[model samples]
Target: MSTETDVDGGDTGDSLTLALAQLHVDAGEVEANVERALAAVSRAADRGADLVALPELFNVGYFAFDLYARNAEPFGGETFTRLREAAADHGIAVLAGSIVEDLAATESVETPAADGFSNTAALFDADGERRLVYRKHHLFGYESAESELLVPGETLETATIGGMTVGVTTCYDLRFPELYRRLVDAGAELILVPSAWPYPRIEHWQTLSRARAIENQAYVATINGSGEFEEATLLGRSSVYDPWGVPLASSGDEATLITTEIDPRTVVDVRDEFPALRDRRR
Candidate 1:
């Protein structure tokens, strides 16, 4: 797409309207899940959203560990192709959340199998061009063995969309503040978090998301799934927070699309007014 820089060394009035697709995805149903995400995108576009963000592992439910090998697709495979088409069709940037990616194990001699998987997030610009791919760097290990099944990401990535510099992270990455700091260092004005966060930790999800926005002084939009799996139930509380840690729009335990208007200027205004980031010691 266009290589013009919008957020950096540009007018602060630039803003973006975002839609968080809190979809209810069924485990192992790729087609149905893709259709659901497409419907959400259409709705978001109709509402004048500049970009849409889907939940982590949206095509296949999070707890479906056994299905990772069976449902995995390569980086430029069908899942990403469909997302690119949808982004072009809707004329909006699409953050097609995390997917189980089958990376040729030969690429990494440490894990030689010819078939390994990674939890990767794919971003497609409005022109249907693949922009960035961010694999989940920090895999959760509380009760799940995601680290064992998925390869950790190597680099952080950011992109320009709707006149805003945006950074992306998958489910468990929200807990790490350093990652967010790195994104901000890369001139990110907005952060998109795609998660399949489970229940009994709703408070943590909300608290951490708000904390990230407050600390980074950037707009944070988190999209989570809503459904029950054989092993866990997803806590669907997708939300968007402003730079000042204000909840612009949020969702409850249901399959719904949460939309919010984010002004990139607000990040500048909040940081200028509060100057929190400037006073950081580390």
Candidate 2:
């Protein structure tokens, strides 16, 4: 459990109570999985979470490669509208895990492809305003059809919310440190990774997440999915890390919520004290 209090004179927005929804995403079951995610939002809000995040491709499970096209929704379509409504309803921000977005039908933002699909995530504020959108940049090619089936995104967006500069990334983006460096350079204080990592890569998950936080001196929260698929089982290890690379809260291979308080001041203090960021040979 996490408690929330003002870090600064009762009016400081520096503190944020965050929750990670490690959900059991059923393959091709968009309705069921989204309901679960929405329920998790309500649960997190009830427990006093300022923001709650879901895993990558949460509505349509990650390993269900064949179902991406069938379930692909346009940006700001039904799935995201519900999440936006949920955010306003609960008065909490939402990091809607990556969704299969139909680029051709989406008229809101610029698309990477004329009529292809992309893996995208959206952040909605407490007032139900769409804050930021991040499309998965580094698509996984190793033993995965993600690279073949979806068009890669080029947008790197961040939003100012919860007293922090929040940035979003997807699962395979974890392997690319340059992306994180770009985020840090863009004034990101907290990076949320909505991942759908599968089995036999526990060490890779933890290490990559922790390393991103450690190197950037920023908060890193990896929101992973749960449940088994036909060919792979999602390794549910949703976690939150501090600026010092400390695990603030985490969950195992189960459908659970990990809630805890995070502060922007902590990131500021750590960077000011250690100043490892200055050591870079840039």
Candidate 3:
């Protein structure tokens, strides 16, 4: 559980290889979901990906509200341990996306409120050490019961990944520019957004992601789930946007893998050239 502040890991002499796993998860099927995540990690590693990121709440399908309480586990429970092992075995970092976390089972951090459940995301380094734990700050209330069933996170988390300062935000948080600003202020060069975005919001998803990258002059990887639940069908246009708002890699509505090579120096270059972030008034 090492925490890296504004320390830049710098460009590790090579372009960082990133893989986004847009997979389908069965509602309430923890074992099957874990297996799918692990398989994705293995496949990413086999393709020489330095890091792999999974979709939001891939363990317990996002739309499965009833299963959230039933299948919720602690931070270091089966889900965390298995992903850590997978990262170690494959020699690749993993972003084990948002999970239905049982707050009563863990003691390291204080709960956001008294509610015993949270949507948490865990990041494991290539060496298999847990680096960051991020709970979703913005919970969806419109057309969803997330806000009613879970507690919203109170803190922001960041860490160094693939020689670049990286930060995280969940699905609903994409609409908030201030959160992304906080990450930029923290010297984050890249932002990973694990989302469970549903239909009719594809334009919003792509626009917000690219806007964050362009304004902050940093890379943004938005990994989304590619499955259909009883309530809604997730629009899986998982993608990676460069500092200039260019699409590095993108996927359609399918369970697939998206890869891209990101240069940490690009952040610096974009900021220096555009200077939009530097010229911020507020």
TM-score of each: 0.91, 0.94, 0.93
| Local accuracy of candidate 3 as per-residue lDDT tens digits, 1-282 | 111111112233468988898887778888987888898899889878888999899998999998898889888888988999999988999999889899888766544455589999989999999888899999999999999999988888789987888899999999998999999999899899999999988899999999999888899999998777899999988888889999888888778887778999888888888898878897
| lDDT tens digits by residue: candidate 1, 144-165 | 9788888788788789988789
RMSD of each: 6.7, 4.5, 6.2
Least accurate stretch of 10 residues (summed lDDT) in model 2? Answer: 1-10
Candidate 2 per-residue lDDT, tens place, 19-91, comes to 8888888899999889998998998889888899999999999999999999999997899999999999999
RMSD of 2: 4.5
Rate residue 6 of model 2 by lDDT.
15
CA lDDT scores, all candidates in order: 0.83, 0.88, 0.86
What is the lDDT ranking, best to worst?
A: 2, 3, 1
Give stretches of model 1 more than 4 Å off.
1-14, 105-115
TM-score quality measure for candidate 1: 0.91
Model 3 lDDT-worst window of ten: 1-10
